[model samples]
Target: MRALRTGPLLAATVATIGVFLSLTGCSVAGDDRPVVMVSTNILGDVVGELVGDEAEVVTLMKPNADPHSFEISAQEGARLRSADLVVSNGLRLEEGLQQHLDAASAENVPSFVAGDAIEVLDYSEGDAAGNPDSHFWTDPARMIAVVDALEPVLAGLDGADSTVISERTADYRAQLETLDDEMSTAFAAIPDERRALVTNHHVFGYLADRFDFAVVGAVIPGGTTLAAPSASDLSDLVDAVDSSGVRTIFAESSSPDRLVQALASEADISVDVVQLYTESLSDADGGAPDYLTMMRVNAERIATGLST
Candidate 1:
């Protein structure tokens, strides 16, 4: 009886030790994956899709957060510096996180700027006129360019499978091409007179440039959400809105729509305010969870809002 009890105790002890070692091994394995830190959620989604299971992507910005003003914690800053690669939207977009990015770069962390991949457009009519616009993801074609530039860089990372990255890149590029075609078709259906756009800020320069829509005006005076519109600026935009006969003004999901609504009210003509996912993506359950979905939703919303 004593020998039988002792044998079962020994088996139980060995099983407990094995389970603990297995758990510890899993943690180490996860940590072994290369860390790719991204500045914004939108690019984070893109990088995550490209890397798949080959790397661990840590996005600094949260869902539906403003890229212009979002800040990171100390731990996040540490991670950024320690990452094998860092990705950001350049052209002075991430005003809040610029310091941390610079710190990481100083530490010799490899970096990729999405803005460097595309033909940058200037803010034509705002306080930021002549400044390069950082909202290139507004146009699907531009995003395709970003994916093209990013593929080779991601493949070059140690521990990343170049073949897998290339395959995923091809698939994502196809989806972006399809999205561009669909947006073109939808925007084409709207009459030329009604294709004017007004927004809370200068967030849609790329989209307007791509789809042949005229930017009537913006409630805010600059390209960033951090800028506040003066009363004179609002008055000027209202006049522009009245003259352009812009029936719908699009507001960004990442920004407050109050200013947009106020602008619509101040306009001489009746205007409808529609919200778009312009800057950042939403949570998984939100309508614009991924980059592709976010663009699709915005395109449909713009088409419908302008059409009506």
Candidate 2:
């Protein structure tokens, strides 16, 4: 097995890649076909659907990994700097990778921020209020918008077949529309009063906005999972949950549910804590292995948890 390179060696290699390419009059990617590196698996899946076999899609985040804190290997970091195009979920979502993405951009790599393609939402309450919500995939309509935006970006890549990209994007947009409709119909069955959400963190803002649900509270009281809940924070959230009469508190599949379970117990009310595929996609054989499946599974789970 090849040992991983790190420290100054990796940084120097990444830094000199551009100079090496310029000296050799060769592409930095070193691949004949276009290579696109995505900061997260969700965007990777969408990019894969559009590019198909046209480009080599490299995803940094693994399935079920926390996007906010996940980091790529030094070798992957070097590869990222050389990618023909780099895609990331901006708005400070990839907290651990901001520096790497910025480095890629500094080198003039064709970088795309998927969050920029959609209508971003701000947290209306809690510690996360006024901050941009990076979890826009919860709204399939926004994802459709992303697909429309990404189609043009992918088409612009050299060696990418514009016709193939366009056709695949259209098909994927239709699927997103269908998912939006299904989610709407499913969420409609929940009583307005019952459509209150309490989760591990402020992750369901977009879903709540799109489905007419209210984000009652969150155990962590922030947008990113990195935030911890103080005793007062948990107490406040518990009070909010009890006052809202929310019977279920949702936890993220990528995160531990102990805090959510503790919140349920602290609430002094009969509340159930359930897990949802909120932050990341699952591996194959898991319930949510892709964007569409993740949203569908989350919708069904949310509706079931909220209704009863």
lDDT of each: 0.92, 0.88
Best by lDDT: 1
Pick out the ten consecutive residues of candidate 2 with the lowest summed lDDT: 1-10
| Location of the lowest summed lDDT over 10 successive residues in candidate 1 | 264-273
lDDT of 2: 0.88
lDDT of model 1 at residue 80?
Answer: 95
List runs of model 2 lying over 4 Å from the truth.
1-31
Once superposed on the true structure, which residue ranges of model 1 sit more than 4 Å away at CA? Answer: 1-22, 29-31
TM-score of each: 0.93, 0.89
Angstrom error of the Cα, residue 177, model 2: value is 0.3
TM-score of 2: 0.89
